[model samples]
Target: MNRTNCGYPLLFPRQNWRHYALRSLQFAVALYLLAFFLFPVGFLFLKALQNPDGTMGWGIIALLFANPVSWESLQNSLIVATGAACLAGSLALAAAALFWKSDIRPSPFMELCGFLPLFMPAFVLASSLDIIVGGHGGLPAMLQNLLGISRANASLLSLTLIEALHYFPFILIALHLSTRASSPQAHAMARLGTSWRRLIRQVFVPLALPGLAFAMALTFLKVIDDLATPLALGITNMLAPQAYHRIAVYGAQDPLAALIAAILFITSGLAWFASLGFIRQNVNLFPVTFNDNRPPPTSASMRGRFFITFLGVVYLGCYAGLILSSLAGVWSHTPLPETYVLTHYLKAFRFEMSSLYNTLIYCGFAALIDILVALPLAHAIAKAPPHWKQRLGWLVAGTLCIPGVTLGIAYLALFRDIQLPLSNLPLDATGLLLTLAFSIRGLPFALHICSLALNSVPASYIEAARTLGCAPAKIVSRIVFPMLRFGLLLAFTLCFSLAAVDLSLAALLVPNENNAPLAYSIYLHIQSPSGMNVGSALAIISFALLALILFGIIHRLHRRQGSHRTLSPPLFPTHRTTGFAHESSHH
Candidate 1:
């Protein structure tokens, strides 16, 4: 029987029971996404455009257009977003070029270590920076006192720099993946005596443009939507901070806050679509092929080793600064902490244990729900009809484009007056809403990872099972599920860590102080004059927990990789089954 573009058999009629089941499952997932993800966002736009008199209008928008505060905030967001994206993209591209293309010989462990900042909470990273470089009490302040330079926080610059540090790894990883696919072009051009500069400018850059654009777009969205960094830095004029302040201070009844959220949502959506276009256009820009095109590994030069060492030391030093500050009894007016003790850690664990428990409960539940929702959607996307596939992609992308802050704002608007369907509880007053919000916000990540894993399942195995009269359910249980164990674990861990420290949703959706998660509690502590040490301690504990989970995932993945390598030599005849698809019969 012939197969459609995907691996499923086309000989089976469209109305086949299996196909119908798949369709029904996909339709259900589509409905869930629409009702829970898309509807709230649509309602946000509607609310922003509607006046209080229950009529369609754009008066608020008109007023916002005329407001100088809106324009200035927009201007600031654009400037900072653009600047941070460029800086991060350039630095990441350079790093990828050196590590992958040049004789850098950057150890895989070192490169992985460099990506640690990507998983750290934004507030934690921001707080770490303040400890290392804040005006009156940090190491940089001490240096400034000696140099006689004025020692006030450089708010905007500090934000940009902090964002760049957190975001560069994303671009670096994207470029690295792109280069993996296009390395033959680089090797072939270099063989013809092309200068490294020309090779990058003419060959690699165009090939990697899609990934580069995506990295920049993601960086921009993250920077623009960040409430923690600006709030932590005490910046009030920025767009995200301004929007947050309106609702946080004036309550959710403020129409102006909804207007700002609408603007943020629209801006985020435009950037996401624009970046998708760039990605699609650049995907096959340099079409070159080779039968066996792996490039030979290069050795590190002395200079290259020195460069990697320098970056490694700088990153380690920043982390050390956080750890040291967390342990300091009193750190003011000193080059280093005057007294180092375990009091801060004890205080955090003793006093903030409830907050930590709340984080686990919330994030653990969210991750579980995220996986449950993602698995069916991912399976459907991989096996659904073409038209349905496109619709599913849009659904996922639309959810991804909705910023977390916008989602929080949307939920706040939509459910502030609604109660649970059968219960007397207000929707916003229970942990259910928080968990639902987190699961929806994390859906895109879970779906993407699950889809990739599902795509990698060997078609031959499924075909063999089908030919033997095995049901679809049996094939999934015996073959697909077993192979996907690692990926599922990875998705769950990533979503859990992210949801655990998600201040954006918790800051708005959480019922009250008693139920706040660790990140929210840390933020609360950081806001007080005497609470910096406690906040540092909380940040330390949170970072350590997240790091442990991340490292566990990494270790398991590495072990799986090694096992795959050991088993591959004897698993089957030479046409290898990899992440997606097997070699054609010609091989």
Candidate 2:
């Protein structure tokens, strides 16, 4: 060996093991993400870019922009989305302000009730809205008829109302946070000999602006991207739904749908970026404090209270509409149906049993397996030194940015041509492959939830176990698993819930009827004639199944949380670092 200034260093080559390991991990993550999300999207974009002769060209894009029909549909979509966002944002803001800021008697439950719309299927909501709008005999339409309005006029109005009602919770959560985050110091300064208008303009609005923007951006994305609503509302010939139709019904004709999807890919990406930008620019730096020298509480007048009560009543009525539609025998055009039957439930269950079975198998297995794998992955990611942590976070973050449909397509592009033989097993079965896809899709989410739980773990306990000579495996099993069970349960339940209802990949991976999930099966039923009753049944059954699962998960979670709250020790101060440091000085 050659002598050097530092002779010890010259004895061997220094290994940068962390860099090598991180690079390898990043490569694996990239491969999985591209296979699952990027390639299929790129493939479609490739198709969209080609001419009939298969040469790369923008002729398809040109044709789409030049066509009035496509423009009209696109324009209609934008207009409707704008209306929905404004209405939803306004309602959410009002509700959040009224409930969260004030000494409202019923606080948390009201907030929870407002979030019910999220659980609703787009088609089911549309169907319920339709029944309410058949309002020549319906309440709103009857009132409008008394004022001498036409049925045509009512449809447009109904669309706005339905969308607003369904989407307002987005704004409520956002604004509620904004309201809460307004530092009491800021409010105090504003209130001390300041004009009310100036106080709101300077203190409240500026603080709340970020929340408003977030809510609006999210609301806009939902309204614009929704396929079921537009289709159910008979706007299928429009841009967004047309894009869907090209994939589902009209793939043989022109490839306009690909172009529209490409547009969505670009636009939604830009929107998300803009939203993130706003959030980054405006996030509060100061600590948010509860109002002290409590601003004298205000109460709504009797008339105002009654008005709020009426809004609540209407909300309950809409919820009832969802329940009744699921059970109705035949919803004749009436104010409200007087009769109902279980035929819808029975028919749907019989028709969708196979689909339900397939979906359950895939979702349940994927979720369970994903959580199992993610435990190690998340521990590594979370517990890694700061120098390495960001690589793992960024790798997962990239997957999160890609839309589900795009990721599904990536899997198609990557795996479509590959074949394998592994230990006498067939390397590719549709069900098994789909299960893998679902699991891969959920990795980012699993990583996120588990990492948060892992981060919360007190390192002292871990060190104590090590000091007692515990093995790594034993330490993880005995100490870590029990502490983080609630988070894992949440991760699995959330993952399963998402996979159970998803239809984004249905077209790409599920071709045969037997492979259809509940959502896809219902979509198929609705696409054909004579599927209304049975379709409603399927929709309702799907809803019921989802509801039951959700209830069970939440109930279990609540029990666990209650146990933690009751059986666990009271809170104590800790340092923010060294893996949740305990009080060094015993008090």
Candidate 3:
């Protein structure tokens, strides 16, 4: 009878200690995630069920289906997302294939151009696209005069072009990481009689499909969650802006947003789940044994090289417009526009301080904390009984497919009336809420990266250190950690960049202007006529900060690799890594 009632009644003291410690840690992290990211999402869903008199009801969801506008917006969002995913996925596949398989003469410069979008924030792309279309002396005006096409007719296509360009880099990174695993294999196969097309279809495509699918899912999430482009493109029926406007202007709090978000979450989550299961089934299908004896030789033809450079230039031109526009003389327009000025930058720095500060405070703290929690979890996962490996792996990546808005909504729901036992602080404090949100949001990415890093650390090292009578701390501080620095740095940089640009949750949860971050600040500035230049300037400043951070990371990695030159073959077998820190690597 006692055995049924008491969990530890028959347990050994050491076993009890280990079990309780692990469970306690798990409980704490789970609570933290739910409190900041999941609960608010639940709250939003609950709100959708509530009646107008604050009573629980399904009227919100009913209104969503009944209203054509709401349904239309959701439909439009799906269309746009699908289009962006296709364009991005195809382009990334081509570029990755070129770099990975063919003896494509490596173009370091072209690589830089191709990846410029990685550094550009979402709002800036939207703004630049808008300016290119609707602003005074913009392309629409020229097209209207030359081709006799109306500006209204040209604007939608123009915005789509801009979004495709901006979203492409996200898909590209996933493609790059996915294909890197295949490139070496494909190269060796190319030397055989297998034709390029056949090799691509057989070896490269199947192997890289995982990355491609992952990219598409991520792009879908990003594009669907986007709030800036609709405003820039002037599409009121776009899903993101609709949800934004619903809460901000309508005050109606339509339950449809919740239903739509649930749909999005379910769809993407299923895709990611299927992909992970596929990956696990095939993780070792291609044993990674290398043909070091016969590495593939490339025959990059002159025409191929030229085509690569041309395509790279086209990619570069998209973001160059923003880089140029951000620093443009106020009146300049058209091809090869006049002198670049620093005045815009000076103004930007002056005005964007609060937003910049908030970005740093939140991203820095949250990413760092996420890493600390994650490192332990990763270590445990890596060391867990081998039987649990595949199950736990998917368990971690399952969070990737969760919709961004759902996480934001979760935070809102969980914290509405919740309080801490010690201090009576409300969860509504934007900074606190933001820190938690960012951390929980970052968990999936961080966990993925850390798991890979930890797995790469050979068990032999830990075992040898233990045999030498080294303490657990000593072993970790020495062997395990030294090899993990690069991965941890990569994880932190990516998490920071993401948090810096995040607008959805911050916009919804952070009510005070004083507590606002860069994304919110830009959103507010863009809301008013007087604030356009200031907003543009602020946007440019945020872009520069992101770029600088990226540069600093690359510089550090170079320095680290430089010192390890004697042992490690080389960091840049091809010096074509992009500037964006997030785009640098998978692990």
Q: State each model's CA lDDT, in order.
A: 0.70, 0.57, 0.60
| Cα TM-score per model | 0.85, 0.74, 0.79
Q: In order, what is each prediction's RMSD in angstroms?
A: 5.9, 8.4, 7.7
Residues 430-509 of candidate 1 have per-residue lDDT tens digits of 97778888889788778776765665566777778878988767777898788778768877876887787677788888
**lDDT assessment of candidate 3:** 0.60
Task: Name the TM-score of candidate 1.
Answer: 0.85
lDDT of 2 at 333: 62
lDDT per residue for candidate 2 within 517-546, as digits (tens), equals 777787666555466557667776766666
Clashes of 2: 5
lDDT of 3 by residue, 1-587 (tens): 11211011211133556557766776677676565546665666676676667787776667667889877776777777777778878987887677566534343222332344543446566565446454633544555576777665454445555567777755654555445555555556666766889877766676556557655766677777766655655666766666666556543254555555565566666656655533411221111121234334535544446656676576555445556655666544566447767776677677678777877898789899789778667655654554465456556667666655665555554565656567677666546777777777778667766765665565666666666777666766887778778778877976777676777667766748877888778777755555655676777666666667656654564465434311111111112222111122211
Sorting all predicted structures by lDDT, with the top scorer first, yields 1, 3, 2
Which is the better candidate, 1 or 3, if ranked by TM-score?
1
- Please list all clashing residue pairs in model 2, or write none if there are none: 36-407, 37-407, 40-409, 40-410, 135-138
Q: lDDT of model 2 at residue 505? A: 51
